[model samples]
Target chain A: MKKIVIITGVLTLTILVGYFFQHKNQRKLTLVEKSDFLQAFATEIGQLWRNADLEGDQLCKKALNVDDSYYQCHPDYFKCLIDKNLIDFRMKKKKVSLKISSSYKSIQRPTHIEYLFPLKVNGLYDLKLRLKDSCREVFLPQRYYPFLANQRDVTIEWDNFNKKVFVDRNLSRVWEVRQWATKVKNNIVLKKLKELPASDIAINLEIVEMQKYCSYQGKHILSAKVYDAMSLHPEDISSPEVKLFRAPYFPWSRKNTKTNIFKIQKKQDITLTEKQSENLCKRVYAKNCTSVPFQSYSSLSSTWMGARETLGGVMEYVTNTVHPKENIILSSKYYPWSSHVHRVGIRGYWDGEGRSMNNFDFGKYPIQVFPNSLDIGFRCMRFK
Target chain B: MIQVLLILFTFISCNQESWETSLQYDLSSINKVNFAKNYLNKGDLKNPPNTWLKLATFERVNKKKCLFYKTPYREKKGVLKIVESLAGKCSAFSKGRVYNDNFSAFRINYVSSTHAEKSNILEAIYSTGKEQLALDIPLINITSPKKYERYDNQLDFSLVPDVSFGEESNQLLLENGKVCHGVNSECQEVVGYKCDKCQNGVVEVVDYNCPQGGSKYCGPNKCGKKNQIACPRGYKILNTKLNSLCFEGSPAGFCEPGLRTYCNEKNILICL
Candidate 1:
């Protein structure tokens, strides 16, 4: 009975083991079958990728499919490529680059990078720019004349700029774009000063006199004197009749070249302080000294040979500089106002008078003159 | 102990007599299946004097046994069950091909015994019904033709090869019908005929196959790039220039201008 029991047990165990192993083998075979299917699919996908010539939609599809099939193995690489390619394709349109530079270092700082903008079919466009420069207010001592003459050039260039503009990180910068078309249409008048004739050497001088001054109807006044040439003596001259009779000239002493007539005119009296005198001259000649607009009498001499000819009119001279030709002078009635001026001899006649006179239609002022000027006595300050 | 042995001997003799009596009645029954059953274990019998008894039961059912009666006799039930089994065997055997090997020897033994018994029982039970005979019952035989002989007789074996499932179906039917019975008309004309085998009592019924035609299989032949691989009949292929100038009848049916191409089936530019 024990033998029977043992024999039965062994048979049962054998059957059970066979059953278990058979199922295990079956499972392994099933896995192998599935792997075969997957392997074939992978091969086909790889072949498609290899055969695909251009890297475009077809390639993208094939690649995506390949990666999808085997994402577990190469997720990062394919993901990055797909993302980068997508971005690249999205922005594949042509773009135009612009850089900007200034004509001079003093006019503008250097820009190191270029900017790009989308291109359009019609290239005609209005560009706007707002840039920062240490010398925003350019004292082109040269541009000053025509600037004062109220004249401007076409195609004024902004410097330190190319077709491109780069923002500086080191400085407190504020740059902007503006419509050059509209901005250029309007004139930019920086500052104004007197423009002296380039031919006659001008000397800013001071004069003092205590002679007997006379008046006409108390509304006009002048220094009473008459003199003969070849001698230099103030009181040796004869006295003119009307006592003052508007001094030497009436209304305006413009283009009055009487120095050859009277040697006693070597010295004249100045009537206003330097500050008051500059203001007076500015008021009188503000329009004539500008190149932009509202200009008055202009001398070709002021704009000759790229030289800066600055002129200051004062009733009193603060410095001991003398004038060579006080050929024309300006004096106002009932007021201590005098403007040392020159009258342009056009057709041999004084067309206008005072520092505000100009031969606008007559004289051709060279384009090279610079009309930069200072108070010569005031303090100069530089901004931070 | 002696008395006990005598009693045991007598008991054995009586049991043997009873077993013999049961076997004799089973062999003499009108149902052949009962006879088959009796014969299954008859190899143990010691007698050889049963020629007349065997002659009385030559694979037939007795007319007198045709009467309907219910009884709890094991042999009678066994005989009926065995008869149905035999009928199955007969059908299987009837369809056997000549060159086939391994003819299911075990099944043959089982079926032959059951079939003989079933025929006998059926004759005994339905002997009262009038006999019906088919006037033109078909008889057919098929053999392989010589290797050198052309197989042109096979309708589907053509140059282009009836590349269609339906056409193949029709050809198979024609070949089968010609081999087993015979066809009355051209296979193509009668190819669509399908007899309802599920409802019909006849074992073998007329069957033809459907024909092959239409774009269901062979699609439009002239497909070009960006064109529909298939189109409705009478319509031709059309190629469209995309980008600024759109092409008509692309797979998507319309094209648009852009850096994009191949809008897929919808025929629109795909934005990245």
Candidate 2:
């Protein structure tokens, strides 16, 4: 009886020890490993969210046998997703995995799985969630867990369902193809324009300046002064008695006398008002012609050589306006002699003056406009 | 006994899954010259791969065929002894081609049997020594024109006068009593000179011998009419206006000679 009891106790002890050892040896997932898995899961979810719309469109096309011309595809899109089970997703903590439904026969699974952890979805998290909401409405009709929304800030170990998730490379390929098509279209337009005969009007390539300063909207700009033909002749020097007086040469000569003539004389077009100047430019150039904006003018002046007398001189009229009755004007860095003086009872007022030219500041004070005063001028700009 | 067996089994499994085989290389056995030649022949210089070996050969030395490769890792302060010992083993066959006297170049052939072999070669080269070349090149000073300076006119300064009246109409006029009509005006005829209408209260007269042989003088009464008098002093009619009509497209205004005046907006003369 004593031997039997001792043997039974020993067997129980041995079993307890063996169980402890087995549990200790079996590797429980660490916090770091769980975090890594969550990161990869988030990345896969992001990719799936992004491709959901494209996938829906493709599926709708296949089901209805219609091209993009067909407008009513929303109902068909949802039906296609349901029919193909493309959005029938199962989420868990153990691993994130995806399998291309039989509908996507062209997409093949990658041989080597990339476990890119700590995926950077810094600024795109909200956008992805919004996309997921649209995708969720179609696939998951039931309410999703609230904790999933806050997963970025919190790490929770979900039920360990053994699965592997992968992002569909076809989604990325579709994106690349669309991007390439746009780039090719732009290149073709540029090539056609370049192949045409060069215009006599000096078109300066301000691509770098446009990209840096003008928000990449314009590639080329008119280099020669606007209303160049109306510029005063260098020989028409105004005496100090008529220094304040300004006017274009009589009958407006078409010859460009100001091209190589930079004298101390009053030059540049100062006769026309803003509306008149703009109309004149539009009439001559026809399209893509307008008064030079302060931004474009400042940028061009900053880089161009011989900008002072050619691009500057006089309070040049610009497109920017501060008041209803006033428009902004720019002057050359070298020549600040044209002061913005105003008289109260004049027909028009000089609204502002940019004396320094470098700071790009326009004065807000209204000044009188003399009938013969020709301190203000404007040049037109052409855009590409 | 059961617990001991479980622990051993667990350890063996973990070892099989996690253990990585280290790469090994015999430096002496590698033919440095042949490796370098093969690397260059593979067009690695033209199209380089993203690797430490390619990065090394990216910097081309001026006036020299050799390339300077810099190690990515920071050199330790006390590794000079080890560097010297390793550099002593660098073969003489790679002189001037792969390395100079100061720099020890390692030719890492990426087209080896396996990725492990390439990594092994990279590791071997890294263990040798870190060499740095200090360049004392002068900074290029570009003399850009002053931004605020007036733009120089392309016109020849020598040809331009300080002050010019620019083709005065009087300079083109013939001397008094000289025939003043038709081509060079060498004959006597009724000479007519347009009056300056802009001069408000001025008058002048010009006496000329006509083809009929008697002298006739035109005065202020003839202003704004046919056979108008010549402009008085300080007043002149623009040749442009003489050839066409009076200022502002009006033909009925006239004035004496040598009078300073201008046309008003109303086509009337305003004396300056």
Candidate 3:
């Protein structure tokens, strides 16, 4: 039998070359070795407002050195956990060793990378190809290290290939990364938006905070999206916490109820009357987010403001660079009645809910292009 | 070192696949005088230098029609030399003197061609490298690409998540007024300072917390902490802003702590 097909092709090429040299020499990043290169993501209080002078969890303890003191107990690095709302880290670990010269110096502070998978998860289907040939062996050497980490201004995002790991100026950077990006250290930009000359996309561009009028009727990433001034309720403010006003949408059924927009959150048209929206859906929590009662509009995710969906079965781009009119909006719009930063003057509350990852205009001076301000977006959804 | 091994062999021959969908030009000089009048003709070239022009782009080869040149290698002031060739042999890189020593990680240089009046010669070399690299070192990222993605894009250095690195003009050392142009480093705190009066976000220094406590006044652009209302005597703070709406901190009438929460159901006494 041809010696049983040459010993099953020499035991599948010696277990795929000894499982790629034992996960490239026994994986160094560990907690208990789960290797395929260890993937990770955690950092949203809105990505630490990308850097409008960082406040909340200070851009993830300065990009993941995590209040350094020498790896804060390094097994291989990454454990993090700041949590007041979120800063969680752990792309399974490995990459701490620094001293600067000796005494563990370390404070040059600036390292916020996240994704570093390099391959070797039992040969992902034992190298039988396809999974875009095992995602081009971790993004074809990251398309040549994100243009040598962008000629040193370093922003290396071959779409977080090898999962993620940007750690500027200490290590784990791409394209020579020495630190400097995020629109040059923290003007916090992502800009691309340009088109302007609307007859009526729904109309609204007040600027300091108002724009989001004609609901950019999407032809792609979800169309009928709306989100009203997120669960309004200032009712002419006095505060016991605005006496509690969560409810934005939900009707009948599991009943705890919450619905209010014209009756509060001041923009005015005045609609609530179902016993003044049930005396404010009996105070607090509220999450069904607008299905009519007084909602003249408030649909996109409803309140606490969030939603734009359809990153179609979620993300996949290592230069697929897909652009169904790419969205994720929210650059700045929460310091008015008080989330803080309105005239963009600045205090705290670092850009959360002000949303936008790029398009500039927080304290001005970035211009090359920035016309269209709010269309309200936020893509990427697949979790299944 | 031979332009760092020809830029590390043009970054490992940019992992092949015909340089992944070519077509990346940033030509400019009237697209190199209409690509030297369509592929080196109309007098095989000569009429480029306003300052300089040897620059090339717009390739074809095989269906035949070329001009890809971009070769310059002695690089390293912060690296950027690119060469990659798969027979499309990337070329065109010339200069006379304009090197910007870590001018925030420089690499794209070509100076010599100017004025034919705006077709955006890389936004006039990125506004002359942000008015000459905003006082040198440790902070240089301000790309300009756009006009059909500027020849495979140039003008995206990335990083501005709360801008820092100016222990004196955001360091690599070189301060004393740190050029304050592309600001951040010597980066005089502006991180989103909006207040021009009701445009609202102000902060050069306005320190916090007033959950009903007073006297704390930060400034440079404006800051407040208030809480000492004796005005029932002659009444001032401008007679409570000429008929109260209580615009200070404004949770709209805050004053909790002790005495069972003094006046908040809109009776508005907000005791300080």
Q: Quick one: best lDDT, which candidate?
A: 2
Model 1 segments more than 4 A misplaced: A1-107, A110-121, A124-303, A312-384, B1-272
* CA deviation > 4 Å runs, candidate 3: A1-114, A119-384, B1-272
lDDT of 2 by residue, A74-115 (tens): 223333543555543334533222332223111100111011
Worst 10 residues of 2 chain B by lDDT: B158-167
- How would you order the candidates by TM-score, starting with the best? 3, 2, 1
User: Model 2 Cα displacement at B198 (Å)?
Assistant: 69
TM-score of 1: 0.12
Write candidate 3's Cα lDDT for B178-234 as tens digits.
211121222233233211111111112111112111211111110111232111101
Fnat: each model in turn:
0.00, 0.01, 0.00
lDDT of 2 at A71: 18
Q: Could you give candidate 3's fraction of true interface contacts?
A: 0.00
User: How many Å off is the CA of B176 in candidate 2?
Assistant: 74
DockQ per candidate: 0.00, 0.01, 0.01
Listed per model in order, the count of residue pairs whose N, CA or C atoms clash below 3 Å is: 48, 19, 82
**TM-score for every candidate vs. truth?**
0.12, 0.16, 0.20
